[model samples]
Every structure is written in C-alpha cells, then in structure tokens.
Target: MTWARIMAPLSGGQGDPPTIAAAVALAEPFGAELACVYTPADVADVMPWMGEGFLGGVQTTALESLKEATAVGEGNARKAAAASGYAKTHFIGLQTPVWAGLSAESRLSDVVVFTSDPARGRGPLAEAFQQMVADEQRPVLVARPGLKVGGVVAVAWDGGKEASRAARLATPILERASRVVILAAPKASSRSFDPNRLKAYYAARGVSADVEVLSDSGDAAPGLLKAAGAAGADILVAGAFGHPRLQEFIFGGTTRTLLGTDGPSLFLSH
Candidate 1:
C-alpha cells in the first residue's frame, strides 16, 4: 500500500523534471524513496572496419554526439532529484542497453514513472518505455508533457485481478478525490460480473463512486479518453495489460496508445 521507492528515467530533456516532481509530490506524503535512472551512451572500444575511402570524420562526430547526450541526460536527472528534494536519489549510469538498465532498476522499486520527451519523436524509446510498463508489473505513473494534475479521477475497471490491483493502489489518491468514476469495459464472454460490484466495493470503503459500463468496441482508448474529459478527470487510473512474458516479447498496444494520447495523468498498475 505504501510507495517505498520510485524509479524515474532521465534522458536530459526539459520535460523530465516536471514528471519527476509530480511523482515526488505524490510520494512525499507517503515518505517514499526516490531513485533516478539514467542510461549512458555505449561507446564501442573497437572501431568498425571501413574502407580507406570511408569517412572517419563522421564516425568521430557520432561518438561525440553520444557522449554529449549521455552527459546531458545524467545532469538533468541529478538536477531533477536535487530540485525535488528527494530524500534518497540513486543515479545509475549504465553502459548496457536502456531496456536492460530499466528492467534491472524496476525490479528494486515500488513504482516507476515514465516521462516522454516532446523533442524526441516517440519511437524506439516509446516502445521500450511501454515494455518497461508491462515488464515491471508494478504501478506506473505517466505524466504528460505539460499537464496540470488536479480534481476528479477516473478508474478504468474490468472486474479483473489487474483492475482490482489498480483500484487498491489508487485508493490513497482516490480517498482524497472529490469525485471518482469507475469505468467498466465489457469483454467477450458467456458470463460477466456486474460493474456495480466494483462501485459498491469502493462505496463500502467510504469513496463516492459512479459506475459506467463501456460497450465492447474495437477501439476503447478514444472512448475512455472522451469519458474522462467529460467527467473532468485530471487523473486516470487503469490496469496495465498484457501477459508477463508476452509483455516482454510484444508491447501492449492499449498501454502504448494511452501513453501517446492526450488527456489526464495516468496511474497504471499490473
């Protein structure tokens, strides 16, 4: 129930601090530890064999760019941790792959916050970030580039174990929410559980709950986003999808799409 540790990735972008700050603010009330993870560039010791006509100058420039990027990333992470007044900050400069470093650190943390860099077009990093989300199987808070978080909250529910876990983890935040909405996405099955079952469950815990069932649609992200907007939800809580091994192999499409889409800050748990 308590957030003991928070892991945040740093990539030397201006957007990282706000994301980290939001997470620290959320965790500070609970006395959670903060850990900052940075991925350093991999500088190969052996230069690739090229013909005499090959341009060695281009290779040198690429190496310099890598070094500069790594340094900037490390500096940004440190600045963020210091500015946030995190009690404990762990800076990991790993020469290994980004995903490997993230996976290793994620295992040691209670939750991980993945922030996107607007300057860098969402590509491999986005994919890796989504993989981290699925791989960790822990709570993840994804902050949009420039979103202010406050007010109503929405919980995307499906009456499953993952949904239950998300609800439990979000209880602390939900308890303080002025309004809470539980969204149920129907599945294809012979028998389905009642959405009010979840609503009543939260009501019993002293939280005001509004339950709504979303019809089965090929695309749920857009509808969910629209609902959250209409509900004035500044924070969206949902369960991270995809099986453990499958997540490692193939990223969750819904999670990836959600991260990319605009709306409120997301609180996700697996």
Candidate 2:
C-alpha cells in the first residue's frame, strides 16, 4: 500500500524549511496528507537546569512557547516553498511531552519525517526522535532540509527483520523512485542474506530492483554509502540496529553513523 499519511514534526527553527519541503515532496507523489506537528521545548522540565535564571524571566515557558511554535510552524508549512499541489497540509500543536507527541502522531501516520541533528545526540530533541523510533512500531525518515527525494532508491538489505521491515515500509517511496538498488554488505557467505530475494520481493510488488554485493571489509556504513552514491540514489533506506536509546546515548552504531553522513536523506525503521 502507498503512504496515505505523512507526519512531520517541526520544531519551528531554521531547519523547518528543508524538513517541511522534503516531507511535502515525498508526500506529493502519493497525495499523502501532510500533518505538521509543532513541538515546543517544555520549559518547566528544563528551566531548573537554566542555572543562572539570567535569561530565564524573558524565556518562554511551556504553554506560551508551544502556541508560538504552533503558529509559526503552521505559517511556514502553509507557505512551504517546495510544497505544492492538491495534497492536504495541516498543523497540529501538541501539549504532551516531546516523546508523547511524536509517539501519538506516529500512530496516526504511515511515516514520520523530521529533521535530525547529529551533534546533539544526547539532547532532548535527539532523545525524543530516538524514543519515537524505538517505542513505536512505525517508520521514521531522518531528513536534511533542501535535499530532494527521488531518482534511484537504495536499500541496505541484510535480510534481518528490521531490514525486511524497512524494505516493506519504504514501498511507497520505492514505488515513486526511478530505480531501486538493493545493496548488501557481504560477509562470509550466508544463505539467509540474499539480495536477490529482496529484489524478487520488490518485483512481485511491481517495483524492480537489482542486487549488488559490497565488500564487508570493515564497516557496513561506508560500503552502503559508497554503493548508494555510485548508483545515484537520492535517498537511502536502512534497518536500524541496536536499541535506540543505547545507540544514541553512546552515539554509536549504524543508525547514528548514517545519520551523521552527508549522503542522502535516510528512511529508517526499527
């Protein structure tokens, strides 16, 4: 089935432009409804950490900041530069915690697209994104603003459940792409990991794909990126490995590594 609904969590900042535009671009092809969720940082939970109280008095508390964020997010998304067409767009301002808001929205969406920050791995925003992915049974696309989503579709296929889920979850995007390439990081040969099987799977679904085996050499991330780049893929879909919290907490694993890459926007599922 195609993606019928897309949820984008906007924090109402410089990152909004690209993130909203990217989500709109992806959703436009399928006429998916784009729900822009405005998330404001909860001041009450964080104000105690402000330490000095110097910039505190003027700083917005939870309720007021959320209203402002929602208003701005709605305005920006309504006039999203690249977002055009008959696809419906709406803004939703949530009062719940970041994790809860993202979680609730995710439940109503086929996929959640949002801007990701690599450097702020341990921050509240980062944790919320990670938690959303981990706690919910939904797909998350970590997108960089301004990056286009089309052309060749790249899938990092290892035949694991997460990878399989990712491939299936990415069906909507894959159907819209011009081509599909299933890139596998080959280690000692294993019967379980067959890129051909994945290609065939896509074929049955009306999406054609080719299989390429890249050397394991050392790390899987580099090989995956190299193959994907060579194939001119504008987007990379991969299975997330490890617990989201542990991975983000230590800033390690394939998910975090790829998130930091300058390659393509990521379509990841846990």
Candidate 3:
C-alpha cells in the first residue's frame, strides 16, 4: 500500500530537519499527509526532582524551558514542512510521555521518522525510537542529521521478519533507486530461502538490483558500511535489530555504530 500519512517527532532539537525533509520527499509523490508532534517535558516530574523548598523556583524554570522548546520545535517543523513542499502540516503538543505519544500517533500513520543524536551516544530518544519500532508494528525511519542522501541504495537482508518488514516499507524509495544492492550476511546453516526474492521483487517494481552474499567475521554495521561504500550507495536501508535495553546498556552498539559511522545515510525499520 502507498504511504498516506507520515509522523515526525519534534524533540526541541535542530537535528530533525534532514529527517523531516526525507520524510516529506518520500511522502509527497504519494500525496501523503504530514504531521509533526512535540513532547513537552513533564512538569510534575520536575517538581519531585527539585531540591527541598526549591519546588517553586524549579517549576517556573521548567515551564519556561518547556515553552521555549515547544516554540522552537513547532517553528522548525513548520519551516521544514513548507520547504519540503508538504501540502498539509500539523503541529501537536504532546501532554504524555514522548514515546507514548509517538506510539499512539504512529498507529494512525504508515511511517514514522526520527533523528539520531551522536553526542549523547543514543540517549532516551534513541531508545524511544527503537521501542516505537518494536511496538508500533509500522515502518520507522531513523535518519542522522547533516547527511546528504541520494542515488544508489543498499538493503541489508538477513531474511528475518524485520528485514521483510523494512523491505516492504522502503518500496516507495526503492522504486526510484538508480541502483539497489541486497547484501546478505553469511549464515552457518544451509537455508532454502533465497535473498534473491527481494532482488526479484525490486526488479518487478522496475528497479535495477544486484544481489550478493558477503562473508565477514566483523560486526554487522562495519560490514554493511563496507558493502555500501563498495556499491557506491548513497542510502542504506536495513532492519534495526538487537534488544533496546541491551543496546542502551552497551552505549548503543549497532544503531550507534551505523549512525556515527562515515557512510551513506541509513533508513531503519524494525
């Protein structure tokens, strides 16, 4: 099915612009609706965190910060949407937890887009994004800010449920891709399923795709990066894997590696 709606979260940061642009570009051809949602920090939680007899001062500061953040986020969203040629735009002020609001909104949309933070090394926001991927049951695209994307595209396929889901969600872009590469990581056991199924699928959609199986003993992110570079791909598409909590505890291994690495921008789904 063609994408009809796209949901983007505004988290009081300037890093979401590229993601917003990508989402709009992907949605425009399909005449999809674009909605931007911002999550304000919880005031109630701030009061408890304040020191003894400092509740009033903390409350005032927190409210001011929240207001500023909301204004900046909303303004950025509007500007980005307009620049990206989105026919319609929405600004939603979230009263609940960021993840909860995003999850709820994602249910109503075909795709969700999120930005990755490199300095904090994948903080709560990344976790929330991953959780949305695992829980939303919809496609989620995570884009790193400041990355220029176009041209060749690579799809990391392991024949898992997540891979299949990602491939389906990325069909719109894949259809327009100049070159599509399906990189299959080596597996120990012999399997009947062929990764060529995806190559054939893209070919049917009028995309020129080449399939290859790579034997690498290194990590998945690095291996994928190498393959993408060799294929001259400017965009990488893959299913986000690994348990969120485990990745967090390890300071964000797979996701962080992909986001921080020097390569083409990645489109992630779970």
Candidate 4:
C-alpha cells in the first residue's frame, strides 16, 4: 500500500508554513501530490443567527468582514504552498461550505498532515484535526519540525484492534524506514500478545523489525515514550483513542500523553 496523495489542511496563519513543509517532506519520498487545502472559518457558522429581522447594517458589515478574512487567508495559504517549492503541490481554496470541502479532500487522500499545534488542540485547525482522526477515521501524520520519513520508525503494538489497524495502515511507511522496532508493554495491558508476531508480520512485507518488550512501569505511556526515544525513532506509529463524553470527547491516557510530547512525530490511526 503506497501513498499517492498527501493532504494538508492549512489555516492561512503562521501554522501554514510548517504544515505545508511537513506535507511536502512526506510526499517527496513517494512522489505523491502534496494537496495543500486552504481551510478558513465557515461564515455560515457565524451568520446563522443573522436572519430576517437581524439582517441590518451590522449583519452586512459582519458578512463582509468574514469574506475579507477568508480572502486574506486564501492569499496567505497560496503564498505558503508556493514557498515550499514542491513541484507536485496543489493549492485548493475553498468556498462557503469549507468544512464539507475539507472532509471531501481528506476522504480522498491517503493520509492527512498536521502541525504540532493542531495535534495538541490549540490551533485554528484543531477541530478539523479531531474530525479527521476520530470522526472521519483517517490516518494522520502529526509532524514535528524538520520532518523526515526515512529514519528509525517505532511501532506501538498491543494486539488490539486499534493498534492492529494502525500497524496495517502504516505498512508503506514502515517498509521505507531504515529500521523498525515494535515496542510492546504486556504488563501494562490486560490483553495477551506477542511482539514477535508483529515482527514476523513485517518480515513478510520485506520490513525487518526488532521486538522490544518494554518494562511496564504501571502506566504505559512513559515506558513507550522512553523506549521510542532510546531507539532514536523519528516517527511513532500508534492508534489514537477517544470516547464521547457528555458534551466533549476525552482522549485516552496513552494517546493524550503521546500527543503532548515534543519529539518523535506520531503516525496515528483511530
């Protein structure tokens, strides 16, 4: 399974540069199209309450302001994409139904790319990031600064459905890594599994992986992070876990901790 299209959603702000650079880096290895989509706030979301009686001068000015902001954002996004100097890059500017356009682009792409800010739920595209991973169930690469694909890649495995799916979807990337390591913490997990099983699975696909069973220090996240850092992994492939709460979504303990880290980019699937 090779990636042919890499999607990066830009907010037309300071974050656009790193996000587009990351997308270009990921796409360079496979010669994939770097689809840089400009995602501005949907004006409809803000003007929904400005109907018949409320459509006064205030409403008119508000609509015009939103349109102007979108235009400015599009210009910024286009400039950022062009600055990347990637030959196969495509810049997409969306209309009023921005969310729908973003979803369609993400659905058609092999994987979505995001900067650390969006992954940490602290950026303009934060909501879009959540929707792509949890709601849309797309594979995502939460890229760090100076992103590179061909390096030591780590796989966090537990034999669960989520981990299994992540490992499977990340096969193409794993195949390209200089070295692959499977980090498993059996004591921290309630399930019974073998790390060598995953190692053998990768062997079938021409990826030689070493199995390392991490000492479960009560919580799994710390151990996993330590192991990945020790192995000098540039990317950690794992599953993103979340559940619906009363009015919000809460990420699982391990997933949350991993997302907060600074190094080792996360290649996640939910």
The TM-scores, one per candidate, come to 0.75, 0.81, 0.77, 0.96
Least accurate stretch of 10 residues (summed lDDT) in model 1?
116-125
* Minimal lDDT window, size 10, model 4: 241-250
State each model's CA lDDT, in order. 0.68, 0.73, 0.67, 0.90
Error of 3 at 246 (Å): 9.1
- Candidate 2 wrong stretches, greater than 4 Å: 47-87, 118-124, 188-192, 244-252
Best by TM-score: 4
lDDT of 2 by residue, 1-270 (tens): 688888877665566666677778878878889887766666455656656653545554644665566677656645653354434887776664655766788898998876667223533356556665676757888775445555788999888888899999899788878889999986722435778988988899999888889877556888888888899888889877665454443433676678777787788887
In TM-score terms, candidate 1 sits at 0.75
lDDT by residue (1-270, candidate 1, tens digit) is: 356787776665665677677667666766777777664444543244433533468766766776777787778767776787677655665664656767788888776776554211353245446555565676777766443333688998767776689888888778777789987667522346687887888888888889877775765677678888889887889876666564443435666667668778888887
| Candidate 3 residue runs with Cα over 4 Å from true position | 44-85, 118-127, 144-150, 187-193, 201-208, 246-254
Which runs in model 1 stand beyond 4 Å of their true positions? 42-68, 85-90, 95-98, 116-128, 145-150, 187-191, 203-206, 215-218, 242-257
Instruction: Estimate the overall C-alpha local distance difference test score of candidate 2.
Output: 0.73
Which of the two candidates, 1 or 3, achieves a greater TM-score against the reference?
Answer: 3
Cα lDDT tens digits for candidate 4, 1-270: 689999999988999988988999899999999999998999878877788755679888888888898899999999999999999999999876888888899999999999888888897898888888887889999998757888999999999988999999999889899999999999989989998999989998899999999878566888988999999999999988887565245789999999997879899999
Q: Model 1: clashing residue pairs? A: none
